[model samples]
Target: MKDHVKKILDELLARFDCLRGCEKEIVTAYQLMEECYTHGGKVLICGNGGSQADADHIVGELMKGFLLKRPVSREYATQLGRDFEDGAYLAANLQGALPAISLGNHNALLTAFSNDVAPDMGFAQQVFGYGKKGDVLIGLTTSGNSGNVVNAAKIAKSLGVSVVSITGAGGGKIAALSDSAIQLPATETYLVQELTLPVYHALCAMIETHFFACS
Candidate 1:
């Protein structure tokens, strides 16, 4: 039992170490997210398959509180006084929700765009309609070459949204279109997807923390 526990701990530590190595990229993403929130812009995320799941997961974390204890505003604290054990709810609600939209969530629109316009233009068309200057468009692709994501990145660039891409090393067209990119060292698609999940989770947590601290 002791040996098993030790092995698990070691693996967890290694994963954390890997995360630390990607610290700069994560910080950059956090800063971008903060800027968008401060300027009243939304985060638009899109991807395919497992990367699509990653996009939605990131939005989920940012839309709600993570592990940190929620913070209460002075108004709530004054009203609740010593009975502020319920302050967590007030704090959670007080922290304004950052706007985020997962492009992968709209199946009907996506299918319509894909069928009528072009498969590659599905995400791009959405961007053309919804994206604005100063918004952040996050494109996720294990291969970094999904046609839809690449087109979306291009549309984002044209609309002046800062494009950020999370992809495997040697990311192709999507990387080329992005303003900045977080490239996982893994070459295998599955490994890249596995690695991307936690990185974006950390990014979301960091962004929320920064927003809470500043606002």
Candidate 2:
């Protein structure tokens, strides 16, 4: 990791002392995410209820500027201006992005699949559709055992997509299914969710610094 990226992670650990022992797994998750984005692969995230919101939150931070402005590269900006009349304007207005998708955000697909086929399999189906080799799937469940998220992880693995699970202590089944399992020290749902926020925020900051920081 770059010094700046590692700094963000260090700050996370300092702020949340409870995350002390999870250092290795947190770094491992960051590595997986960094590798996935570096290889031109997107991320697929899934969860349930509050965890679902967290998944969307992660996508929000990733797909646009989080801590940095992330302006387009000069080469792309120049090409944009040359290719179209408003290309320069468009380029100036757009932000650099890390591609990501929240599986639970597709209400249409989720509801239809849940009603027609299997409720727990909705996320799994989306994983099968969006996941490809080199992609990464992140599943968040307070208990580490949301059936749908677990199923999604399973499918992600079959498709050769790496899996990262963020959950409370013990990490349940999803943790076992993951390539990197970040089990927060807290076990209660709310406490676990609280810890989750900072961890992911730090992850986003680390990744953004790695790819978009001004050197």
Candidate 3:
């Protein structure tokens, strides 16, 4: 049992160590999130397969309190009095309401766009419709070579949205397309995806602590 626990801890520590190389990019992404919150801009995240799951997971963490406590807003305090439950506090405070959308959803629209236009245009189409200037678009690709994610970054750039990409260390097309590229040191797709999960969770926790703690 002791050996098993130590092995797991060592693996986790190693995974975190992989992030040291991309620490600057991670900080840049945090800054982008802070900017978006300050300016009332939204964040849009998209990816494929495991990357898609990562996108949704990051959004989920951002849409709710991670570690800090978010209080009820004055408006809600007045309406609900002082004894409202945690759910009411969240509803009143408008906690986790920072307008983030995962483009990986909406399969109907995605399939239609892929069928009519090009498959690679599915995510890009969504970005064209939903993205705006000053918004943040985060694209995740293990290999950094997904055409859809790359084109979405291109569209995001054309539309003046700040683009952040999380990809493997080889630096695929997404690295060139994005404004800030966070490259993981791992080469294998599964390892890259595994490393990406905590990187995004850390960013989400940082954003929450930085912007939404006081409500």
Candidate with top TM-score is 2
Q: Give a tens-digit lDDT track for model 1, residues 1-215.
A: 22332343345437766544454555566667778888999999999988888888888777666645445567766676556778556555664466888899999998987788788898898899999999999999988888889999999999999888998888677777776778877879999988887677666666666666444
Candidate 1 lDDT score at position 175: 72
Task: Put down candidate 3 lDDT per residue, 1-215, tens digits, no spaces.
Answer: 22332343345447687566676777777778778878999999999999998888887887766766666576765666545556465465555556789999989999998888899999999999999899999999988999999999999999999999998997798888777798989879999998888778767766776676556
Compute each candidate's TM-score over C-alphas. Answer: 0.79, 0.96, 0.85
lDDT of 2 by residue, 24-51 (tens): 8888888999999999999999999899
Better structure of 1 and 3 per TM-score? 3
lDDT of 3 at 192: 93
CA RMSD of all predictions = 7.2, 1.2, 6.5
- Give me the displacement of residue 39 in model 3, in angstroms: 0.2
- Compared with the true structure, all predictions reach lDDT values of 0.77, 0.92, 0.81
Ten residues in sequence with the least summed lDDT for candidate 3? 1-10
By lDDT, the best candidate is 2
